[model samples]
Target: MTDPGMKCTRCRQPARFRLPAHNAHFCDPCLDLFFKRQVQKAIKDYAMLRPGQEVLVAVSGGKDSLALWLTLEELGYRTAGVHLCLEMGEFSEASLQSCRQMAARLGRPLHEASLGQLTDGLSMQEIVWATRRQFCSVCGTFKRHFLNRLCLELGFDTVATGHHLDDEAGRLLGNLIHNHLDYLQAMWPVLESGGDAATGFARKVKPLCRLEGAEIRAFAQVHELPVAQGKCAGSKGATLLYYQKAMDQLEADMPGTKHNFYLEFLRQKAAPPPPPQLGGRCQICGAPTMSELCGVCRMLAQARQWREKRRARLAAEEAAAPTP
Candidate 1:
């Protein structure tokens, strides 16, 4: 039992945080200990990592990711950080700096990639415009591909992400609402390596899946971890954001609703059938794809074609102009 005005659950100190999902309140130190123990339990329960295996943590300098990296390192894991700069101007630069600071604090190596480098100097906005696709979809595809490639190239056995319980619950609700069976089936704490091994699509793990977003943010703030403080510029009015808000409202109305929903999803024994194979490797990038080219490869190709057409049109217009 917890009293809102009482001392910490584990200690006599004044309580600083309350976790409604767990029905517990804790002081700063106790909260930190509780958060770390939950993360360790999640890892053990899911077998997310094996001892001595190298891990590349996908860090965005956000609270959840930075906190995850710190916790993994503290738990004696061989973890390194990878930051992808989506070339979203100041956001990208600030994220990179935060990642650098975190790596320095942990005294670990940090690898970096950028949308420009991956897309031939094209920014995310440019790629979206060139492909006429949704910004989030295009960005997500590129980041997934880029991270997997990096993990393989760097000889990491697993790639860790900062997907917490709230994220999982919200995503599940979204899938349920939209009837996205394939995606829902693929949602798990751990996903085995898929695609061609030669290209380095390593297994994915989420050690923070059992924890909530608010708790993770609290942990980060308590520890003063270096994390980017703002949301991405492009995520405004995104469908995912709407789903998250809805989940939050539901959770507020019914305590532990999110935790219960997420745990039930994991406990269900009937595994959904695997999705139908989408065919062979992409022709251009050798990535797994249903079509002739993977989404990333196809988007890049389209961007290239668009650029050429624009250049040719500009040249023709300039030629048609009278002597200037």
Candidate 2:
């Protein structure tokens, strides 16, 4: 619940947004300060990054990512934006444009990667329908592969993403429900780089993990950030969204529910075992993997095989058809 009549807690000016958990409201400047402080605190608490380290922010053209890039840039970090273009359609283009706009505001360039380019013209949507796999499962595999490739190629040692408290809380719920201890072990604010070449990821950090998604969106709105208007078409009906909505309801009923929930999880989780050793380097991409092919390579191989089978089937059908 918000009190529109409230004033900024710091300067007593008109409050643009209300934070129920914190019992506070803020105008624009104060909100900006609040955003920076939260991110900085998370970084400091987790030792996520060091000064002068290059940070590549994985932006999805969403409000949360934009706010993070803005806050990091404002805090004087050597940050750059990386927008992985899935080239699925309008959503990808819009996302790219938003990232470009955000980077332009700070007079910096945004780096890019493309699914089509990596897959030789196959998109994730194509792979989804052809392979009968879920959108997120297929997409996440490719994204991580490419994100790691790009981060390493561009000489960035650290990669920051926009996973907020809502994201983590939802993940925690799902993992606990399924008793997925492997994923639970991997979850953290700062994930250290892989010990060997096969880890296939940079030092990944989520500075926004301590903040709520709604609060981050509010900050973006009040600051007039250019966020992509809608979510990806494939993201509809996801179970993660359900968990997030459940968390939201809990928060509405009881303030500070989300923050306390995540903090307590971090406090009490048992010692996580070491990750399983990779089988070997991928045959195709030489990436660390338990399988013969890395995830991205396997996806591309499956996509191409599916396309070939479809073409052969169509040709056979045409050959058997009566002369037209």
CA RMSD of all predictions: 2.7, 2.1
Top candidate on TM-score is 2
Q: Please, what's the RMSD in Å of model 1?
A: 2.7
Candidate 1 structure quality by residue, lDDT tens digits, 40-159: 888877778886567899999899899999999988898999988887778788899999999999999999987787778777887778988778878888888898888887888689
**For model 2, what is the alpha-carbon lDDT of residue 144?**
79
Positional deviation of residue 123's Cα in model 2 after best superposition, in angstroms: 1.3
In candidate 2, what residue range of length 10 has the lowest lDDT sum? 269-278
lDDT of 2 by residue, 36-91 (tens): 89988989878888866679999989998999998888788889999899996888
The local lDDT score (0 to 100) that residue 115 gets in candidate 1 is 72
Model 2 CA deviation exceeding 4 Å by range = 195-199, 270-279
The reply for model 1, stretches above 4 Å from the true place, is 1-6, 270-279, 314-324
- For all candidates in order, the CA lDDT equals 0.84, 0.84
